[model samples]
Target: MKVTWVWSIAALALVAAACGGGADIEVADAWGRPSPSVAANGAFYMVITNNTDSADHLVAASSPACAVAELHESMMNDGVMGMAPVGPAGIEIPANSQTTLKVGGLHVMCIDKQAEFVAGDTFSVTLEFENAGTVDVEAEIKEG
Candidate 1:
């Protein structure tokens, strides 16, 4: 009985260790707006949730559906709204928090799209992180 208990405890410890001590970043609710027929640019939005003890950065993004993908942030000056690139470092997600990429906020810019963005369409976007590595998520295109 004692030997069995010891082995059980050791197994549990190994399991916990395997799953702990890492930046756990998750992507959810990823969606994009349907682009106009003659538009070459599009945008993607989603929620990035970080559940780890340390902060992480979304370094990059890519998709075969677009010629280029970049992280961008919206800016407003004197009631004029504009946008700028978020740079190659990408957006940061603080420890144990969530960052949302919305229509007029932070978003993924798709340049020279390979196809038209139509409603009810889905595509894959691979996101690279500083700590969590790469994650590929399917993004749904909808009319906005």
Candidate 2:
């Protein structure tokens, strides 16, 4: 009986080890606009740090705060400002590197705002990744 119990414990430990002992990729300080203050649209920004020694990409994103969520980039086209969708070829996070989505840069544009996000309010957003799967994060609404 003692032998059986010891083997069971060892098996459990092995299983835990195989499952990485609950280790997961870390995300920090994720926040964004809950809704546009004056317009029907808004944008969100966050910093994503890839702790693992592997390359990853932000494939997709979604939020209940808006009718549509899309990855966008603001750029200058012959002195004209333009924004466009970044499709399946998503934002890349190099191994051991960090990427920041900020104003006038790569960001998630929330279109057709559904709810207003005031400062101190939190909203849920799901980010899809190539390897880490879907990570649901809360964004704190703040002044842009």
Find the candidate with the highest lDDT and give its number: 1
The weakest ten consecutive residues by lDDT in model 2 span: 19-28
* Per-residue accuracy of model 2 over 1-144 as CA lDDT, tens digit each: 999999999999889767653324545677775454567887888888776689899988899987998999898889998888876779887786788888878888888877866788887888888888898888888766
TM-score of 1: 0.82
Model 2 spans > 4 angstroms off: 1-24, 33-38
What local lDDT does model 1 show for residue 21? 50
Where model 1 places Cα greater than 4 Å from the true spot, the runs are 1-23
Task: Write candidate 1's Cα lDDT for 28-72 as tens digits.
Answer: 889999887589889999999888888899989999878999999
lDDT of 2 at 14: 89
Steric clash pairs (candidate 1):
none
Structural similarity to truth (TM-score) of each candidate: 0.82, 0.76
Model 1 has an lDDT value of 0.89
Q: How well does candidate 2 score on lDDT at residue 42?
A: 78
